[model samples]
Target: MSKISDVILRGVTGAFITNSGVGKIGMPAEHSAGLQQAAASGIPLMAKLPSDKFGTFIGYSEVGIGAALLAPFVPNKIAGAALTAFTGGLLSMYFRNPENTQADGIRPTQEGMPLAKDFFMLAIGLALMTQNEK
Candidate 1:
């Protein structure tokens, strides 16, 4: 990869993931309500886990992914795969719950927009993964 491309990928994607991971780890309470609500909406399995624990798990995973990507020694493909799986779970929650979206069902409602943004994460992850195949 060109130096500029390397910097853009590592800098932009790494920073984004790192910030996300920090936010998740630092603010479990803020996300608890939405987590519980999603469980209530369709993902009954989520309901079985304590909200705080679930949040912590998510936080740890994000932190790990962020760290993996930011660490120079770690392979981009591994980080990309982890990010893809994480975002896939998020998208699954959004798609599984109709109430989370607007009348059109594809567009997210006010509550769903946060979840909707995972599309970008998915795209970023896929891009990183594909780049590594060359």
Candidate 2:
């Protein structure tokens, strides 16, 4: 059985991620292009994909991860692993972009605050994965 905290965490994160994914699935061409360009800085392979395709792919991936998190039947470890991997990619993108960081290279610039906040999600994912079942 999952704790109330776990349920709340999963519900909130799942809904947020799912909505973001849905939005991306129908993203404007310019939006997709910009996102692809930014992602390419960290994952060079992303540059090879067409902007529309990239957007759809990312959307579907997020939806799947969100569904996993939302499903009570899904194991916490499995859902956490997915979230961790996704957030890791996001963090990588944030760190790889010089424009997103400050002079210290570790802190976020004004533009990077949104991405930097993903660190909290990463921490939550780690906690979910490591927590023992009650």
Candidate 3:
């Protein structure tokens, strides 16, 4: 691996390690509500995962996302990146075109988290990926 690649991987992996680690040791604070909603969406599917397993799923998810985002940089990086992305995407799906509609130009960031660029990011990110790719 090139030094530059090493540095980039180091930075990305470190961030994944930190955030995912938090999900394991504590919780993915910024992403918790989304995940819970995701789990709640699929009652039977999520119910199979015990309460204690929430963090485990989250840990593997973060690792997966970390690995995916790092896939181009390092083969192993896909482990974390894809995992977290799957979790994030799973949660994001629920947010997309939410069951309850919002007024024009308004999006909610959880119950009381207020609305901001994060909504744009969430929507844009969703659009960028979900859009038809020919």
Best by TM-score: 2
lDDT of 3 by residue, 10-93 (tens): 355546444754557445543555555555663435645655556657676556554444444443333333433454544444
Ranking by TM-score: 2, 1, 3
Which pairs, if any, clash in model 1? Answer: none
lDDT of 3 at 20: 56
TM-score, every prediction: 0.74, 0.93, 0.43
Using lDDT, rank the candidates from best to worst.
2, 1, 3
Residue-wise lDDT of candidate 2 within 77-110, one digit each (tens)?
Answer: 9989999999998999999988899999999999
Where does candidate 3 stray beyond 4 Å? 1-18, 25-38, 42-44, 71-101, 104-106, 109-134
Q: Candidate 1 vs candidate 2: which has greater lDDT?
A: 2
lDDT, model 2, position 24 = 85
How many clashes in each candidate?
0, 0, 23
> 60-88, model 1: which lDDT tens digit per residue?
77777877767766666776787798778
The residue ranges of model 1 lying beyond 4 angstroms of the native Cα positions read: 1-3, 26-44, 132-134
